[model samples]
Target: MTGILRLLTARRGAGRLHWTDWATYAYLGLAVLLMFGPVLWLVLSSFKTPAALLEFPPSFLPMTQKEVRVEGYPQPLPLFSVTMEDGSTRELAQVRRVGLIAQMVDPKAPGTTVRVAADKRQPVREMAFAVSNYTEPLAKYDFLRFLENSLFVTLIATAITLVINSMAAYALSIYEFKGKTLAMLAVIGTLMIPITIVLVPVYLVVTEMGLVNSLWAVILPGAATPTGVFLLRQYMLTIPRDLIEAARMDKASEWRIYARIVMPLSAPALAVLTIFSIMWRWNDFLWPLAVLTKSEVQTLQIGLNAFQGELQTQWHYLLAMTVVTLTPVAIVFAFLQRFIATGIANTGMK
Candidate 1:
């Protein structure tokens, strides 16, 4: 917390700001606005009504027309600020509208109705949040099941990816053998292949294994990523060779050396890889969509399709669920982000 405060209050070298400081602060301010402005808009819009969302001039605040109940009125009437002929404004409840004129009534005097031009009246609105945008969907859809499926796929797949990639990296970095360079090149080579190119073949293979509509179909195929292997391997190369030799002289097994020494020392790199793996598995859409067809097993990304339809889409609900879906990834990144710079910088060392 003190570190955060220091960063937030940082200035130019314990003295008055220089021109460069002004430029740097301006650039940083713009960058922050560009990054977080849309996210702020999305969170606010998720609380807006359908009509307010469709308005031509979008409002930053969630606003709804104020309504009031008057004596002898069967329903609540929308309140409006009406301009009278004397050029004074009065707060009146709108009873009905005909042509360009609105019949306005004073809530205190229900017997008299005053007709005012629609153009002369503005809606009396207040900041209101439509909580139903979030509530209705949870009540109507099987979000809990979708959440479970997504959590299962993301967690299991990430664990498998880390284990497999770290093992491959350990072998590649620690042992020298025939075709080692070629194997490393081939692993790195897979990064060039666009995911779209392999979707069909991967789907066919998954079908052959009879894992369609299964969470394993999503988890197993992406268990070993070349990127993870390359990152971990490069970082592992920086580990001193003497550490392994000393472990061997101590009668420790290869697995013990890998687990006890290599793994613990490679903490930063592992954290970076873990973050990548979680994001990849959690946000994966097309592959999960192709594999999990059954509603019972569908992940959150696929389940978001429920809000989209042939005729109309529920943007409010979609936006709300999207915020919900982003929460876990944000939390994970927040916790693990400190390792990114350390891991990436050291990976370049021979």
Candidate 2:
């Protein structure tokens, strides 16, 4: 790992770079842009005001029109740089707009007004972030409640998924049952079935169980994912059977063996599953949307969806809320990603 980091970050000696090296750097740069450019845009746009968001020629940075207080005006007037007829420019404050013409006043001489073509004037703008875009929604909406619900659902569901999937994987990998092959095949076969097909049946079952409008409605239905089971079972198969035999010879109980021996050794695979489960539960919308109908039970994603109205959508608030929602998932991935490649690459070995 240290060698890999050194190769990645080390400076080159005094030599011309090879064509392949240039090509590799270009590919890496493009890949990084493709992966993170939109995310960076989203974060930056979250800071923009509503008017800035609606601007035709979008800017990379958050900016707002500069305003100045004029003597006669009751409110601050928007400042503009007006181009004069003889190719001169002056800073003026816009009082009003009448079709193609704009009523402007010089900040120094507020008593006099000048009429200029609106096209000839450009609004003075400065880098400004609309923090209210984030603050207003958190204040007006039940943001904390929704965040709590989302956290509860993600954490509980992920825990349940890990426990259930790991146990299933343990059974399938270690035990010598009569129909073990058929059971493994059946587990793998579920992967071919799309979640859409199962939605109605799952909802019906949850309704029958009186879990609708409850967090469990979303959590329980997806607790045992086939992908988790398959990945874990493949990884568990690589564990030496002699370990289990030695534990048995030492009079270790099955539960003790599973808890102490199997689980610790499967940490990398479990970490991989934990990350997958967190992402799945955190970003899940359709299942929760179908299950959680009440405002009290809604997750952050559903709450964010509420910003859309029949006629107009609150893009500014929505973007800000999206950034807030993505933060926890990003943190989880950052911490657990070290085990991902190792878990995946070694799953099929031996």
Candidate 3:
């Protein structure tokens, strides 16, 4: 009992943190803000009107100008309060047909209206929500078509990627072959070569294959990636050889073992690869831009390019479409993120 009390007291003495720990926490807080601040701004800005978006000294929260329609006004006029030369204030009533003259009313008197120049009117603006920014783009632009194309390409490409990469990783990890080392080296070698260096050749091949202007041109070329194979192979190596030998002792076919044993055990790795593949295929711009020339078949990223005119950009629509583009990837990450954490932790330990 005396020894236990001494050990507890020592732990209590060491539990108190110094200034460095607090400083580290503060730094991490700032880093997190810096990372997510723009994303928060993008989401908020998607709900703002064009006029509100262009306001000087930009607002982080979405807002719109306040307006009211009076008895004789044909359109809604901006609401304002007028302060007269006599230091009396009146609520906005209406504007005159002539010059910048605005009519004002008194809250105390129901039937009272007064005339004031536009200079004397202090405009009032209130927080306004603009949901049309999201809806209008989908209605005016063929955003639905672009969204469909993006989904089709992302899903198909990711599925193919998982199948092909997993098979390759399985072969390299489990099966003994004469040239297995060379094959693994070849896969790793491709990673050192930048995609930009092969862009022209890839485009030409797609052109010769008659895949240009088609979604297949985008999907086929990226169906298999070296990084996916490497990731899955490394994770698969951590699985014990005893399991595979035991399955073989049971007379399980190689394909059966791969499908039933390997796949289920590698769920964490597959989840990680699924997220990576989805992000790549969904956000891919250059390859899709090079191959898909038809407006009807263009991906969301390419379709978003249409908003940028030579002189002016439709920022409201651009921001809204950007939010739309990011939604699916965000959702996929949300669901599969735990798997990713588990996979990385296990892989690192291995």
Q: Among all windows of ten consecutive residues in candidate 2, which has the lowest summed lDDT?
A: 6-15
Ranking by lDDT: 2, 1, 3
- Regions more than 4 Å wrong, model 3: 1-28, 93-120, 348-350
lDDT values of the candidates? Answer: 0.92, 0.93, 0.87
Clashing pairs in 3: none
- Per-residue lDDT for 1-350 in model 2, tens only? 89878655544445676666677778878998999999999999999998999998899999899999999789999999999999999999999999999999999999989999999999999999899988999889989889999999999999999999999999999999899999999998999999999899988999999999999888898899998999899989899999999999999999999999999999999999999899899999999999899999999999999999999999999999999999999999999999999898868633
Clashing pairs for predicted structure model 1, backbone only: none
Residue runs of model 1 more than 4 Å from their true location after superposition: 13-15
Candidate 2 stretches greater than 4 Å from native: 1-5, 8-14
Q: Model 2 residue 260 lDDT?
A: 98
Prediction 1 TM-score vs. true: 0.95
Q: Write down the TM-score of every candidate.
A: 0.95, 0.95, 0.87
In terms of lDDT, the best-performing candidate is: 2
| Cα lDDT tens digits for candidate 1, 1-350 | 99977766677778887777788878988999999999899999999998889987999888988999999999999999988999999999999999999999999898999989999999999999999988887778888788888899889988899899999999999999999999999999999999999999999999999999999999998899999999999999999999899999999999999999999999999999999998998899999989888999998998899999999999989988898888899899999999999998988733
Candidate 3 lDDT tens digits, 96-151 = 52577766654345266677887887767788778898898899898999999999
